[model samples]
Target: MPFTDHERAYLDAQHIGRLATTGPRGPQTRPVGFKLNTDGTVDIGGIRLSSTRKYRNIRERPDTEVSFIVDDLEPDGPGAIAPGWGRGVEIRGRAETLTDTDPPLAPGAFSREVIRIHPRRIISWNLDPAAPELRGRTA
Candidate 1:
């Protein structure tokens, strides 16, 4: 599914997410600190000297699945029923490692290594009970 404007905006608002990759062993997932660029790409930073399974997987195959929990809705008032946590957004796309030669990393974030995700689909759902209006939507 294609990404909607709102969904894109939501993804851009987030600063961190989990990245999933397939390796020779099996599927692997890890927490990634990220930054969303205006061009609609996600940049993940980490040390380049280390050799992690995720990095290795990307080296083998660039295709990956990334997801992040953006928001969790909760009750705000007394006597008001509490709403469950809101659903998160998941993105499936091809990932590529960025080198220092690429558009240099942003300030404060270590720029030794970065992975960019080019999404092909976006999936989201609402986890709030009071908000039955929340339903899974694909884009």
Candidate 2:
């Protein structure tokens, strides 16, 4: 609910994100295909999702904080005046394994479990454009 219109639009345009999870050794980050749910949660679907280290860490520590990031990158051209830095949104949230789905997302996968991220905070830089619906909102 806290996502501004531009932020929402930016997220809606992206398909992949990095999910950072706490591990026994330290922190582990993995690229995950995520679906932005209508209820404002990110659904991370993958084969053997329940057996992933990210899932295991979250299961072991329900209060674990996970950071999800989706960015738009462009390479600086040969004569570009300014360096091109990444533009994207960073979302920090809590994660949980969801297995209520009947069919597995991947072919011949064992479980239909998905990681759901509940966004607690979102930070973005040059990642959103001024939108009509976001006229009075802050990015």
Candidate 3:
């Protein structure tokens, strides 16, 4: 299922996301900061010019997957709550590198190109174990 407007907004509110790709060495995972657009596309930055492997892989194979956790889950501390409640979203999409102009990055940052993701499918789940009523809601 695809994400709804509300679910898309929830995903956009998140600051960090995980990107998964297949390289010559096999599965690769990296943390990234992303911007979600209203048109169901995602902009990902923080790639270095020298990071050719990831870019090459994505170029050769546009199919890719991304995941983001939307809930605020801080590990429980001595006085913190034991179980945290939140939701997570996963998207499968075709990735393409945007080359019209240099991506907006901080000065001296590694990545200058933005990878645009066009989502094909989206799945979401609430991580709270006690919240069975909220299960299986597609966003």
Candidate 4:
């Protein structure tokens, strides 16, 4: 599915997103710097990426269902969860880790190793010009 302008804006505004993957021990999650590719897939990179738990989880279970989320306080205050006060996105998709180096999408992320995500189900809240509510598609 294609991402809306608001969704893309919020995603681009944030630098780090939480990645969740299930492995042998159960579900695991970690925060990592990411970049949005031109094809709509999410690219992840970090130091010692291949050795990280999130990377290992994806390698161990390529079929693992992954969920990525990026959200934050509205602004000057911490009360960013009152009613329709949240701004961010949740992406449910399949993920995999690779070692092939791709063209640089951003700085500070590992170039040799990366986690790529193909979003199937996605949702966004409180980010719209006309209607700032829930928006997205589910598979």
Evaluate all candidate structures by whole-model CA lDDT and list the values in order: 0.59, 0.73, 0.60, 0.79
TM-score (C-alpha) between model 3 and the true structure: 0.67
List the lowest-lDDT window of 10 residues for candidate 3: 129-138
Clashing pairs in 4: none
- The clash count for each model shown is 2, 0, 3, 0
User: Candidate 1, residue 123: CA error in Å?
Assistant: 0.7
How are the candidates ranked when ordered by lDDT, highest leading?
Answer: 4, 2, 3, 1
What digit string (tens of lDDT, one per residue) describes model 1 on residues 1-139? 2554555655666666788888888888787767666676667776551266776788677545544334445446553333454545666677787566232335444646667777656565443334434344443
Clashing pairs in 1: 1-139, 2-139
Taking all chains together, each candidate's TM-score versus the true structure is: 0.67, 0.77, 0.67, 0.84
lDDT of 2 by residue, 51-111 (tens): 8998888888889889989876634666322237666778888888777663323535535
What TM value does model 1 have?
A: 0.67
Better of 1 and 2 by lDDT: 2
Off by over 4 Å in 4: 76-84, 102-111
Candidate 2 displacement at residue 76 in angstroms: 9.6
Clashes counted in candidate 4 amount to 0
TM match of model 4 to true structure: 0.84
> Which 10-residue window of candidate 1 scores lowest in summed lDDT?
126-135
**Clashing residue pairs found in predicted model 2:** none
Residues 26-49 of candidate 3: C-alpha lDDT, one tens digit per residue: 877677677777676777777573
